[model samples]
Target chain A: MAKIRPVGDRVVVKPAAKEEVTKSGIVIPDTAKEKPQEGTVVAVGSGRLLDNGERAALEVREGDRVLFAKYSGTEFKLDGEEYLVLKESDILAVLS
Target chain B: MAKIRPVGDRVVVKPAAKEEVTKSGIVIPDTAKEKPQEGTVVAVGSGRLLDNGERAALEVREGDRVLFAKYSGTEFKLDGEEYLVLKESDILAVLS
Candidate 1:
Protein backbone atom coordinates (compact mmCIF):
# COMPACT_ATOMS: atom_id res chain seq x y z
CA MET A 1 0.00 0.00 0.00
CA ALA A 2 1.18 3.52 -0.73
CA LYS A 3 1.87 5.70 2.27
CA ILE A 4 0.21 9.10 2.54
CA ARG A 5 1.80 11.94 4.39
CA PRO A 6 -0.60 14.80 4.90
CA VAL A 7 0.71 18.35 4.77
CA GLY A 8 0.75 20.89 7.58
CA ASP A 9 -1.62 20.10 10.43
CA ARG A 10 -3.73 17.94 8.16
CA VAL A 11 -4.81 14.45 9.14
CA VAL A 12 -5.81 11.43 7.16
CA VAL A 13 -8.68 9.42 8.58
CA LYS A 14 -10.27 6.09 7.80
CA PRO A 15 -13.93 6.84 8.32
CA ALA A 16 -16.12 4.51 10.35
CA ALA A 17 -18.79 2.65 8.44
CA LYS A 18 -22.18 4.30 8.24
CA GLU A 19 -25.05 2.77 10.20
CA GLU A 20 -27.74 1.26 8.03
CA VAL A 21 -30.42 1.00 10.68
CA THR A 22 -31.86 3.60 13.04
CA LYS A 23 -32.17 3.16 16.80
CA SER A 24 -35.93 2.83 16.32
CA GLY A 25 -35.46 -0.29 14.08
CA ILE A 26 -36.09 1.66 10.90
CA VAL A 27 -33.84 0.77 8.00
CA ILE A 28 -32.46 3.89 6.32
CA PRO A 29 -31.66 3.94 2.68
CA ASP A 30 -28.04 4.46 1.65
CA THR A 31 -28.76 7.83 0.01
CA ALA A 32 -30.51 9.14 3.11
CA LYS A 33 -27.71 8.35 5.53
CA GLU A 34 -25.49 11.09 6.88
CA LYS A 35 -21.76 10.88 6.37
CA PRO A 36 -19.93 9.30 9.24
CA GLN A 37 -18.39 11.79 11.64
CA GLU A 38 -16.13 9.29 13.42
CA GLY A 39 -12.88 7.80 12.23
CA THR A 40 -9.54 6.42 13.21
CA VAL A 41 -6.47 8.51 12.69
CA VAL A 42 -4.37 6.95 9.99
CA ALA A 43 -1.76 9.62 9.64
CA VAL A 44 -1.07 13.18 10.80
CA GLY A 45 1.07 15.97 9.56
CA SER A 46 3.50 17.95 11.59
CA GLY A 47 1.75 20.76 13.41
CA ARG A 48 1.29 24.11 11.78
CA LEU A 49 4.29 26.39 11.84
CA LEU A 50 4.22 29.09 14.47
CA ASP A 51 5.51 32.62 13.92
CA ASN A 52 8.66 31.78 15.83
CA GLY A 53 9.53 29.08 13.28
CA GLU A 54 8.72 26.17 15.55
CA ARG A 55 6.36 23.34 14.63
CA ALA A 56 3.54 22.79 17.07
CA ALA A 57 2.78 19.25 18.23
CA LEU A 58 -0.49 17.57 17.35
CA GLU A 59 -2.66 16.16 20.12
CA VAL A 60 -3.91 13.06 18.28
CA ARG A 61 -1.62 10.26 17.21
CA GLU A 62 -1.99 7.37 14.82
CA GLY A 63 -4.67 4.82 15.74
CA ASP A 64 -6.56 7.29 17.88
CA ARG A 65 -10.30 7.27 17.36
CA VAL A 66 -11.52 10.78 16.68
CA LEU A 67 -14.67 12.70 15.93
CA PHE A 68 -14.58 15.38 13.27
CA ALA A 69 -17.00 17.99 12.06
CA LYS A 70 -19.72 16.92 9.66
CA TYR A 71 -19.17 17.79 5.97
CA SER A 72 -15.51 18.60 6.57
CA GLY A 73 -12.45 17.18 4.81
CA THR A 74 -11.70 16.04 1.28
CA GLU A 75 -12.33 12.43 0.33
CA PHE A 76 -10.08 10.37 -1.86
CA LYS A 77 -9.27 6.76 -2.64
CA LEU A 78 -5.90 5.08 -2.47
CA ASP A 79 -5.27 1.46 -3.38
CA GLY A 80 -9.03 0.84 -3.35
CA GLU A 81 -9.37 2.14 0.23
CA GLU A 82 -10.99 5.45 1.08
CA TYR A 83 -9.58 8.22 3.23
CA LEU A 84 -10.27 11.79 4.25
CA VAL A 85 -7.86 14.65 4.70
CA LEU A 86 -8.71 17.56 6.95
CA LYS A 87 -7.10 20.03 9.30
CA GLU A 88 -6.60 18.95 12.89
CA SER A 89 -8.80 21.78 14.08
CA ASP A 90 -11.71 20.21 12.25
CA ILE A 91 -11.34 17.17 14.50
CA LEU A 92 -13.54 17.97 17.45
CA ALA A 93 -12.46 15.32 19.93
CA VAL A 94 -10.63 12.07 20.48
CA LEU A 95 -12.76 9.19 21.68
CA SER A 96 -11.69 7.23 24.73
CA MET B 1 -21.79 53.31 14.68
CA ALA B 2 -21.10 50.24 16.79
CA LYS B 3 -17.53 49.03 16.89
CA ILE B 4 -16.77 45.44 15.95
CA ARG B 5 -13.82 43.56 17.37
CA PRO B 6 -13.26 40.29 15.59
CA VAL B 7 -12.04 37.34 17.64
CA GLY B 8 -8.95 35.16 17.18
CA ASP B 9 -7.34 35.84 13.84
CA ARG B 10 -10.70 36.83 12.40
CA VAL B 11 -10.90 39.98 10.30
CA VAL B 12 -13.84 42.24 9.59
CA VAL B 13 -14.08 43.47 6.04
CA LYS B 14 -16.28 46.04 4.32
CA PRO B 15 -16.90 44.45 0.94
CA ALA B 16 -16.60 46.50 -2.19
CA ALA B 17 -19.90 47.17 -3.88
CA LYS B 18 -20.80 44.78 -6.66
CA GLU B 19 -20.27 46.08 -10.16
CA GLU B 20 -23.42 46.34 -12.24
CA VAL B 21 -21.74 46.48 -15.66
CA THR B 22 -19.11 44.33 -17.28
CA LYS B 23 -16.07 45.81 -19.04
CA SER B 24 -17.62 44.57 -22.29
CA GLY B 25 -20.56 47.02 -21.89
CA ILE B 26 -23.00 44.35 -20.74
CA VAL B 27 -25.20 45.18 -17.75
CA ILE B 28 -25.86 42.59 -15.05
CA PRO B 29 -28.94 42.61 -12.87
CA ASP B 30 -28.74 42.30 -9.09
CA THR B 31 -29.85 38.65 -9.16
CA ALA B 32 -27.12 37.72 -11.62
CA LYS B 33 -24.25 39.30 -9.68
CA GLU B 34 -21.61 37.30 -7.89
CA LYS B 35 -20.64 38.15 -4.34
CA PRO B 36 -17.85 40.70 -4.10
CA GLN B 37 -14.43 39.13 -3.52
CA GLU B 38 -12.61 42.39 -2.77
CA GLY B 39 -12.82 44.41 0.40
CA THR B 40 -11.08 46.76 2.81
CA VAL B 41 -9.90 45.62 6.17
CA VAL B 42 -11.80 47.37 8.91
CA ALA B 43 -10.92 45.39 12.03
CA VAL B 44 -8.58 42.51 12.88
CA GLY B 45 -8.42 40.19 15.81
CA SER B 46 -5.33 39.51 17.79
CA GLY B 47 -3.47 36.70 16.08
CA ARG B 48 -4.20 33.05 16.75
CA LEU B 49 -2.58 31.59 19.85
CA LEU B 50 0.45 29.48 19.22
CA ASP B 51 1.30 26.38 21.22
CA ASN B 52 3.88 28.35 23.15
CA GLY B 53 1.28 30.78 24.47
CA GLU B 54 2.29 33.57 22.12
CA ARG B 55 -0.01 35.27 19.64
CA ALA B 56 1.01 35.24 16.00
CA ALA B 57 0.90 38.55 14.18
CA LEU B 58 -1.50 39.04 11.29
CA GLU B 59 -0.22 40.15 7.90
CA VAL B 60 -3.12 42.42 6.89
CA ARG B 61 -3.66 45.57 8.91
CA GLU B 62 -6.43 48.10 9.11
CA GLY B 63 -7.27 49.91 5.85
CA ASP B 64 -5.56 47.42 3.60
CA ARG B 65 -7.33 46.52 0.38
CA VAL B 66 -7.54 42.75 0.09
CA LEU B 67 -9.03 39.90 -1.86
CA PHE B 68 -10.59 36.95 -0.07
CA ALA B 69 -12.10 33.62 -0.99
CA LYS B 70 -15.65 33.80 -2.32
CA TYR B 71 -18.37 32.10 -0.23
CA SER B 72 -16.21 32.37 2.87
CA GLY B 73 -16.91 34.29 6.07
CA THR B 74 -19.99 35.12 8.08
CA GLU B 75 -22.15 38.08 7.08
CA PHE B 76 -23.79 40.38 9.55
CA LYS B 77 -25.24 43.86 9.69
CA LEU B 78 -24.56 46.47 12.29
CA ASP B 79 -26.27 49.86 12.26
CA GLY B 80 -27.52 48.90 8.77
CA GLU B 81 -23.99 48.52 7.37
CA GLU B 82 -22.86 45.10 6.22
CA TYR B 83 -19.63 43.40 7.22
CA LEU B 84 -17.91 40.02 6.94
CA VAL B 85 -15.92 38.18 9.57
CA LEU B 86 -13.49 35.46 8.53
CA LYS B 87 -10.17 33.99 9.51
CA GLU B 88 -7.08 35.80 8.26
CA SER B 89 -6.10 32.65 6.39
CA ASP B 90 -9.14 33.14 4.16
CA ILE B 91 -7.64 36.39 2.90
CA LEU B 92 -5.86 35.39 -0.29
CA ALA B 93 -3.89 38.53 -1.02
CA VAL B 94 -3.31 42.10 0.11
CA LEU B 95 -3.84 44.58 -2.67
CA SER B 96 -1.21 47.22 -3.23
Candidate 2:
Protein backbone atom coordinates (compact mmCIF):
# COMPACT_ATOMS: atom_id res chain seq x y z
CA MET A 1 0.00 0.00 0.00
CA ALA A 2 1.27 3.46 -0.89
CA LYS A 3 1.32 6.06 1.87
CA ILE A 4 1.27 8.92 -0.62
CA ARG A 5 0.43 9.54 -4.24
CA PRO A 6 2.38 12.11 -6.16
CA VAL A 7 0.31 15.29 -6.15
CA GLY A 8 1.50 17.06 -9.29
CA ASP A 9 2.83 15.09 -12.25
CA ARG A 10 5.55 13.60 -10.12
CA VAL A 11 6.22 9.86 -10.15
CA VAL A 12 7.71 7.54 -7.56
CA VAL A 13 10.06 4.96 -9.00
CA LYS A 14 11.54 1.86 -7.44
CA PRO A 15 15.03 1.56 -8.81
CA ALA A 16 15.94 -1.48 -10.89
CA ALA A 17 18.52 -4.08 -10.01
CA LYS A 18 22.05 -2.74 -9.64
CA GLU A 19 23.94 -5.99 -9.25
CA GLU A 20 25.31 -8.40 -11.77
CA VAL A 21 26.97 -11.68 -10.82
CA THR A 22 29.59 -13.40 -12.92
CA LYS A 23 29.15 -16.90 -14.37
CA SER A 24 30.77 -18.05 -11.16
CA GLY A 25 28.13 -15.97 -9.35
CA ILE A 26 30.71 -13.51 -8.13
CA VAL A 27 29.25 -10.06 -7.53
CA ILE A 28 30.65 -7.20 -9.52
CA PRO A 29 31.79 -3.94 -7.98
CA ASP A 30 29.89 -0.64 -8.25
CA THR A 31 32.82 1.23 -9.82
CA ALA A 32 32.95 -1.17 -12.77
CA LYS A 33 29.56 -0.39 -14.26
CA GLU A 34 27.04 2.32 -14.93
CA LYS A 35 23.88 2.71 -12.88
CA PRO A 36 20.54 1.22 -13.94
CA GLN A 37 18.25 3.08 -16.29
CA GLU A 38 15.05 1.22 -15.50
CA GLY A 39 12.55 1.46 -12.68
CA THR A 40 9.04 0.44 -11.56
CA VAL A 41 6.52 3.20 -11.17
CA VAL A 42 5.04 3.23 -7.72
CA ALA A 43 3.16 6.52 -7.60
CA VAL A 44 2.22 9.28 -10.00
CA GLY A 45 1.26 12.90 -9.44
CA SER A 46 -1.80 14.73 -10.79
CA GLY A 47 0.25 16.56 -13.41
CA ARG A 48 1.83 19.97 -13.39
CA LEU A 49 -0.21 23.10 -13.97
CA LEU A 50 0.78 25.32 -16.85
CA ASP A 51 0.74 29.10 -16.87
CA ASN A 52 -2.00 28.97 -19.47
CA GLY A 53 -4.51 27.71 -16.92
CA GLU A 54 -4.34 24.11 -18.10
CA ARG A 55 -2.93 20.92 -16.66
CA ALA A 56 -1.25 18.46 -18.95
CA ALA A 57 -2.00 14.76 -18.77
CA LEU A 58 0.83 12.34 -18.16
CA GLU A 59 1.81 10.06 -21.01
CA VAL A 60 2.98 7.27 -18.73
CA ARG A 61 0.44 5.77 -16.38
CA GLU A 62 1.13 4.30 -12.98
CA GLY A 63 2.56 0.75 -12.83
CA ASP A 64 4.41 1.19 -16.06
CA ARG A 65 8.07 0.17 -16.54
CA VAL A 66 10.00 3.22 -17.64
CA LEU A 67 13.35 4.46 -18.83
CA PHE A 68 14.76 7.53 -17.12
CA ALA A 69 18.01 9.34 -16.61
CA LYS A 70 20.26 7.81 -13.99
CA TYR A 71 20.40 11.03 -12.03
CA SER A 72 16.95 12.57 -12.17
CA GLY A 73 14.18 13.07 -9.57
CA THR A 74 13.90 13.91 -5.86
CA GLU A 75 14.68 11.07 -3.50
CA PHE A 76 12.92 10.74 -0.21
CA LYS A 77 11.73 8.12 2.24
CA LEU A 78 8.13 7.12 2.83
CA ASP A 79 7.50 4.91 5.83
CA GLY A 80 11.18 4.01 5.62
CA GLU A 81 10.83 3.11 1.96
CA GLU A 82 12.86 5.08 -0.57
CA TYR A 83 11.07 6.62 -3.51
CA LEU A 84 11.72 9.10 -6.29
CA VAL A 85 9.49 12.00 -7.29
CA LEU A 86 9.98 12.69 -10.96
CA LYS A 87 8.19 15.08 -13.24
CA GLU A 88 6.31 13.50 -16.12
CA SER A 89 8.73 15.05 -18.59
CA ASP A 90 11.64 13.42 -16.76
CA ILE A 91 10.38 10.06 -17.83
CA LEU A 92 12.16 9.29 -21.08
CA ALA A 93 10.14 6.36 -22.37
CA VAL A 94 7.51 3.81 -21.42
CA LEU A 95 8.84 0.35 -21.97
CA SER A 96 7.00 -2.35 -23.86
CA MET B 1 35.54 29.88 -19.19
CA ALA B 2 32.71 27.38 -19.77
CA LYS B 3 32.98 24.84 -22.53
CA ILE B 4 29.25 24.95 -23.17
CA ARG B 5 26.43 27.25 -22.24
CA PRO B 6 23.21 25.47 -21.44
CA VAL B 7 20.75 25.63 -24.28
CA GLY B 8 17.13 26.36 -23.45
CA ASP B 9 16.32 25.95 -19.78
CA ARG B 10 18.38 22.98 -18.71
CA VAL B 11 20.96 24.18 -16.21
CA VAL B 12 24.17 22.29 -15.56
CA VAL B 13 25.25 22.10 -11.96
CA LYS B 14 28.52 21.37 -10.26
CA PRO B 15 27.88 19.38 -7.12
CA ALA B 16 28.60 21.33 -3.96
CA ALA B 17 31.08 20.34 -1.28
CA LYS B 18 30.35 16.94 0.17
CA GLU B 19 32.86 16.73 2.95
CA GLU B 20 33.51 18.68 6.10
CA VAL B 21 36.57 18.35 8.28
CA THR B 22 35.97 18.40 12.00
CA LYS B 23 37.30 21.08 14.31
CA SER B 24 40.26 18.77 14.75
CA GLY B 25 40.61 18.94 10.97
CA ILE B 26 39.81 15.27 10.62
CA VAL B 27 37.72 14.41 7.55
CA ILE B 28 34.21 13.10 8.00
CA PRO B 29 33.15 9.96 6.23
CA ASP B 30 30.41 10.10 3.60
CA THR B 31 28.29 7.51 5.39
CA ALA B 32 27.92 9.81 8.36
CA LYS B 33 26.25 12.65 6.45
CA GLU B 34 23.58 13.42 3.94
CA LYS B 35 24.54 14.63 0.48
CA PRO B 36 24.88 18.32 -0.30
CA GLN B 37 21.87 20.33 -1.49
CA GLU B 38 23.72 23.25 -3.08
CA GLY B 39 25.17 23.44 -6.54
CA THR B 40 26.56 25.97 -9.02
CA VAL B 41 24.73 26.48 -12.29
CA VAL B 42 27.22 25.91 -15.08
CA ALA B 43 25.22 25.39 -18.24
CA VAL B 44 21.55 25.80 -18.94
CA GLY B 45 19.43 24.47 -21.71
CA SER B 46 16.70 26.52 -23.25
CA GLY B 47 13.55 26.05 -21.26
CA ARG B 48 11.41 23.16 -22.28
CA LEU B 49 8.93 24.19 -24.93
CA LEU B 50 5.30 24.39 -24.01
CA ASP B 51 2.67 22.78 -26.19
CA ASN B 52 1.58 26.30 -26.95
CA GLY B 53 3.82 28.52 -29.01
CA GLU B 54 5.82 29.62 -26.04
CA ARG B 55 8.94 28.94 -24.08
CA ALA B 56 8.90 29.58 -20.38
CA ALA B 57 11.64 31.74 -18.90
CA LEU B 58 14.16 30.33 -16.46
CA GLU B 59 14.18 31.82 -13.01
CA VAL B 60 17.85 31.04 -12.35
CA ARG B 61 20.65 32.23 -14.56
CA GLU B 62 24.15 30.89 -15.04
CA GLY B 63 26.62 31.22 -12.13
CA ASP B 64 23.82 31.15 -9.61
CA ARG B 65 23.67 28.81 -6.64
CA VAL B 66 20.58 26.66 -6.86
CA LEU B 67 18.67 24.02 -4.99
CA PHE B 68 17.56 20.93 -6.84
CA ALA B 69 16.66 17.33 -6.20
CA LYS B 70 19.64 15.05 -5.82
CA TYR B 71 18.11 12.48 -8.08
CA SER B 72 16.59 14.76 -10.73
CA GLY B 73 19.09 15.13 -13.55
CA THR B 74 20.48 13.16 -16.44
CA GLU B 75 24.20 12.86 -15.64
CA PHE B 76 26.61 12.88 -18.53
CA LYS B 77 30.25 13.69 -19.24
CA LEU B 78 31.15 16.21 -21.89
CA ASP B 79 34.79 16.44 -22.92
CA GLY B 80 35.55 14.63 -19.68
CA GLU B 81 33.71 17.27 -17.65
CA GLU B 82 30.74 16.20 -15.54
CA TYR B 83 27.53 18.17 -15.78
CA LEU B 84 23.84 17.99 -14.97
CA VAL B 85 21.23 19.22 -17.41
CA LEU B 86 18.04 20.14 -15.64
CA LYS B 87 14.73 21.57 -16.73
CA GLU B 88 14.14 25.05 -15.40
CA SER B 89 11.16 23.78 -13.47
CA ASP B 90 13.33 21.20 -11.71
CA ILE B 91 15.16 23.95 -9.96
CA LEU B 92 13.64 24.30 -6.52
CA ALA B 93 14.94 27.78 -5.66
CA VAL B 94 17.66 30.29 -6.39
CA LEU B 95 19.78 30.85 -3.35
CA SER B 96 20.41 34.44 -2.28
Interface RMSD, in order shown:
14.1, 10.4
Which lDDT tens digits does candidate 1 get at residues A1-96? 125555457777887765622322333345644533777898876667676746698889999877787578655544456666678998987877
Model 2: lDDT equals 0.61
Q: Which consecutive 10 residues in model 1 chain B have the weakest lDDT in total?
A: B20-29
Best by DockQ: 2
Docking class of 1: incorrect
User: lDDT score, residue B66, model 1?
Assistant: 60
Instruction: List, residue by residue over B1-96, the lDDT tens digit for candidate 2.
Output: 268777766778875654511221223223422322456788666665767867765556677765565567788788876777777666643444
Q: State how far residue A48 of model 1 sits from its true place (Å).
A: 8.5
Best by lDDT: 1
Query: In model 1, which regions exceed 4 Å deviation?
Result: A1-96, B19-36
